[model samples]
Target: MVNEPSNSANGGARRPWITTVAILLVVLLAVGAYLKLRPRRIRISVVQPALQAVSSSITTNGKIEPIHSFEAHAPLAVTVKKVLIKEGDRVKAGQLLLVLDDSRARSDLALARTRLKTAQAGYSALLAGGSQQQLLVRQADRQKAITDRDAAQRQLSSLERLQQRGAASPDEVAAARDRFSRAQADLAQLDSQVRYSPQDLARSKAEIADAEANIAVAQETIRNSNIRAPFDGTVYYLPARLGAFVNAGELLLQEADLSQMQVRAFVDEPELGRLAVGETTKITWDALPGRTWQGTVTTVPSTVVNRGSRVVGEVLCKFDNSDRLLLPNLNVSVTIIANSKDNALTVPREAVREDAGHSFLYVLQGNRLHRREIKLGISNLTRVEILSGISQNDIIAVHSFSPAPFSDGVEVKIVENPS
Candidate 1:
């Protein structure tokens, strides 16, 4: 048989202090009522998808370069005698930019002229009759030959008559005829060699032509010594100064027409395949803030190359820089408008997340969140396009960087806006 305690003993064992126990029980009941009457709290906001304009652009770095440029060089060894055009001076085509020491060229030209004069005189003498002294000697020889022939003829006639009269021998008569024949032969020789021949004329003319070519070359060299602008442009580089000695083919100056410019933008090799001509480009220079220049894609990249530390493809952009604000080799920022659209359904970029090559969004369904994958289209910096898996009125969650992010299916209060 089990022994049982009395009622008074049981009561005493159960309660350390009945009055204190009653007080604690009442406090707990009060706390339970207060908790049931209060509302849950959350720090988040919900917004429906918006139908707005969306576009995308490719931003990159580029440099400005002149379209037309000319570099002048010395044609022969020369000293810089004068510098007429300074750096940054605008000049017209054919304007004299500088002058090299032309003394050597001038002296060479004088010598060429003297040679030309000599050649011309020789050519003229060949074309005209023989020279004065030569003509005088030929004429005197012809007259002497004529007189000797006449005397020989008279002697021959006398000898013939003497032979006929039987007072002279046949041998004497034959000697007189031979003398006459010799005189006649001498006169004929003088006549045949009298004046200019065709061969002489041709040789003298060829020498004249050679001398004229030399004179023309010397004049051209002298003209080249005076450096002149090849086109209307601004002188940007001047390496030659007064009294500076420069050798042939050495750089003297550089000038360019800054009205038309090219913006060379280097793009990553991976992104080069998407580039195409006729794309619009916007340019900005750090040196001149708040100013923008516009251009169009003139050429697509043909090959990839290593530029600095990156393997990139270089693109050419053409711009009408008539204002002369853009300069050569100036680093600038470029933004290309690859594609754009108006009145497209879009969402804030922050609400989109990427997972396994697909984008997702957390939707505010009821008091909890739902995870849904979405299809995207053209996206700009601030907005993203939602093509499917969502509607215009669907509420999406937005996560902030400084706060503790929310998880899917978490209970949340509908705070239309929480700042």
Candidate 2:
């Protein structure tokens, strides 16, 4: 029965195949159009603002120092005679720390004493009218002058009597009177030499004073050669060695009361305004790992200065060091608590954006980002305090996963909801 197939039968069979093919093409076209025209949702990271405790702080390098410290220096050019204590030794007030060679000072003192003695002798002589020898000479001269005057007076009287009686010539009487007058003048000159004028007394007194001042200075120099602690402290630096020569004003030793300490912190110039007195500070030393010290800002920088490659301000901080674990001039790290708040509405700092000097945040509303201006309070390394324009329950976009920029009214899909 190999007979020709009917055209209507074959046509009916092909029609079903053609219809299925056309339906498949229509489905693909519809899918392509939908993909090209539909709104794109960007994958992003989102976070919810929450109430948290936040603190703003500044950290910088610092140096440990003593609050009340003492330093001893060589008072004059001398050799160190004795070292009574070693470095790091605890000392009491008035404790002798070192002694310098005071032979020169002693010699100077002896010379000054001799000068003072001589000056005093001269001054006493002036007060007593004159020196012992000068007084003796003046007394002898006065006695002789008195005798001569009396003799001349007796002779003048005799001459007058003789003249009246015509026993002596007029020329002899005149000569006796002249002798009496000359003797009287000589006696008067000797008396004036014994008395001292006011100007002479003052000059003598000044010499005595000058000699006494020299003696005092020499004595002080001798005393200073024996170095002593001014207060109870630890000797942290001892540059003077036994038998070592040092110049005047050379550093000998340094000591401090370790019960309290200070830190000279160098803060960047831009961070100076945030520093205030009484602010809490935390300190740590590299030499002592894991150890921490507490302090407060005592002094703020008045001016900025160059520190290495940066401009910085020196801040003073005071703290207690009852244990005395820290040493002077040791480099340390400091943290100043600029501001802190508790139970503040805060969000991730990355969530906030800046535009035209104003802060804004991308708030997620119904799966779409909306730019809303925000008032910020304080900020920390990781979080920022939201003063207004947002609630703790509000969801905000932190960052986007795609390269496309965020805009207002843009749809987003949260890829990461970081806690």
lDDT of each: 0.85, 0.92
The sequence of per-residue lDDT tens digits that candidate 2 reaches over residues 190-257 is 87773789989898888889888988988998899999999999999998999999999999999999
**Can you write out model 1's per-residue Cα lDDT over 129-247, one digit (the tens) per residue?**
66767668878999999999899999999999999999999999999999999999988887787377778888888888888888888788789888888899999788898999999
Q: Give the worst 10-residue stretch by lDDT in candidate 1.
A: 399-408
| Position 221, candidate 1: lDDT | 79
**What TM-score against the true fold does each predicted structure earn?**
0.64, 0.80
C-alpha lDDT of residue 321 in model 1? 87
Which is the leading candidate under TM-score?
Answer: 2
Instruction: Give lDDT for model 2.
Output: 0.92
